[model samples]
Target: MNDSQALGRISAVVSENDVVLFMKGTPQFPQCGFSAAIAKTLSQLGVPFTPVNVLDDHAVRQGIKDYSSWPTIPQLYVQGEFVGGCDIVHEMHQSGELAQLLRDKGLL
Candidate 1:
């Protein structure tokens, strides 16, 4: 698929799922440390998220970065808003902000 097509798919996934993670692999078995970290964070919070494995599709891997204007795997979205990548998520988790955000979004 072209960039636009890929973006469309990404967009659909984002909008359709209240919590969606565009990552390098499945949440249960992430390929990258960042992806693994984010997945673990969500799991710890008992948040249910739709995992979009970018490794399975080149278009999506590139398209996700373009779609969010954030160059990184393990991109997070809650209630259709771009949250952040691993480091940001880590900070939020440490600061207790991640749980708050998830609670505010009714996902936690």
Candidate 2:
């Protein structure tokens, strides 16, 4: 797919899923450390999320970066909102903020 198509696809995925993770690989087999960290955090929180494997699609990999303007993978979206990447996720997880957010969203 092209840029516009990729963007459209991403928007649909985020809107359709209550929780979304645009990462390098599936939750079962993350391709990178950062992706793994975020996936683990979400799993540990018992957050039911849709994992978008960017590695499977070139357009999606670049599309997600452009879509979020975050220049990173493992981007988290909760209730269609942009949550940050690995370090931010890790910090939040450690501080219990991640769990709190999930609970607030009825995802935990």
Predicted structure with the largest TM-score when compared to the true one: 1
lDDT of 1 by residue, 1-108 (tens): 888999999999999999999998898888999999999989989999999999999999999999989987889999889999999999999999999998887777
Off by over 4 Å in 1: none
The lDDT for every candidate, in the order shown, is 0.92, 0.91
Q: Between which residue pairs do clashes occur in model 1?
A: none
Q: Each model's TM-score, in the order given? A: 0.97, 0.96
Model 2 TM-score, 2 decimals: 0.96
Report the error of model 2 at residue 96, Å: 0.7
Measured with C-alpha atoms, the lDDT of residue 33 in candidate 2 is 92
Candidate 2 deviation (Cα RMSD): 0.8
